[model samples]
Target: MRLRGRKGIRETIESQHDLVVLNPAEWKGRWAERFGNEKPIHVELGMGKGKFISEMSVLHPDCNFIGVDMYDELIRRASEKARAAAGREDGSAPDNLALALFNIERIADVFDEGELRRIYLNFSDPWPKKRHARRRLTHAGFVRQYVRLLDSRGEIHFKTDSRPLFEFSLNSFADLNIRLRRISLDLHKDGPAPDNVMTEYESKFYEQQMPIYRLEAVIGQEALAEHEASLALAERQP
Candidate 1:
């Protein structure tokens, strides 16, 4: 599904080149140097319209954030809001933020192993078919990729409105032996968390009284070793 062709999305995103990296692969393993800081890097995979990442960068100047989405049109919209938020006449984003357009499957090519401190999966697509289970963002294969990309203490924060997907993800994490924390079955039953940054989809779901499920999972040394062993065992199955 392509976004309506905005007259100049390419130019708009390019004008914000300082904030949006059209070729993120060039900065792989050197993203911190590009940011000119050793601050921990956090990325929101599938960032739609950039609401959360833009607000988060403003709130936490000490940390660097990069929002990754495959869509350029959405990135253009995000760039506009980011530039406006920073009050920049030019289309640059906040100093602590960046945006990237890249294939999520090739995420490793854009970031080295252990280069990231945290990854956010906000309202990711739920590939509901049983055969498509591996395509789910929280599937064991993707979880393993995230494990390789994140530091030992790194965590993945996932939020979704789909109960079936959420339940499947919970099992996936357990199967991968990832440590789970901060489980919330209904994130907005009371109110948004103090530091909660809502995505565009989240806002719409909230208005419909949908229960949002969230959890934080981490892959430490033990978990990674277990993951590796599982892969080895799977190879031996044949």
Candidate 2:
């Protein structure tokens, strides 16, 4: 669903600097300063078209939200959506929301250790081929990186329509012995949860009678210790 050849997409994203972060690395460890508050920061990796993040920002004014995606067109679209949600015609975003164009693999470069309070992975690419498993957002390597950026009470909330991806993610987290909770194999079986925010893809999937899977990975001290031990063992092996 990558958009290409969109005229002026880059210009549009740059024009809304208030909503789009062009140099996120500079904001590392200072996200609160960027938001002008000390509220917890929540990030949605691979945020597509920005429906959920924008809505969440409006709903939770006490928290700051950052939507990260690599595509210029998608960032531009999200900026527009953020502005529309805030009812601003002058291209301003909601005070708590910001969109950024960056590669998810290099996320650690933009946020300092324990900087993020929550991370969201909604309908992420499954990367179905077995050989491409490491590219999955929930891969153990990526999970380790996420663990480094999360505070002691931080959490990673993941949702997907692909069952295989869900299973793979479950195994990945288990390997690290990370604590998980609120796991749902069929998220909308009894209708959407009261606090759930649906992304555009999720909304379409729901209408098509697709089941969504979700889980919350908590970063507890014991789990962090195990993760560090595993990394140490790997280094020793090599």
Best by lDDT: 2
Off by over 4 Å in 2: 89-91, 220-238
Candidate 2, backbone clash total? 0
Please, what are the lDDT tens digits per residue for candidate 2 over residues 177-209? 988778998899887766899999999998888
Q: Which stretches of candidate 1 lie over 4 Å from their true place?
A: 88-91, 221-238
Q: List RMSD in Å for every model shown.
A: 7.7, 7.7
What's the C-alpha lDDT at position 11 in model 1? 84
Model 1: what TM-score?
A: 0.89
**What digit string (tens of lDDT, one per residue) describes model 1 on residues 106-136?**
8889999999989999999998889998879
Q: Relative to the true structure, how large is the alpha-carbon lDDT of every model?
A: 0.87, 0.90
Considering summed lDDT, which 10 consecutive residues are worst modelled in model 2?
220-229
Candidate 1 lDDT for residue 15? 77
RMSD of 2: 7.7
Query: What residue pairs clash in candidate 1, if any at all?
Result: none
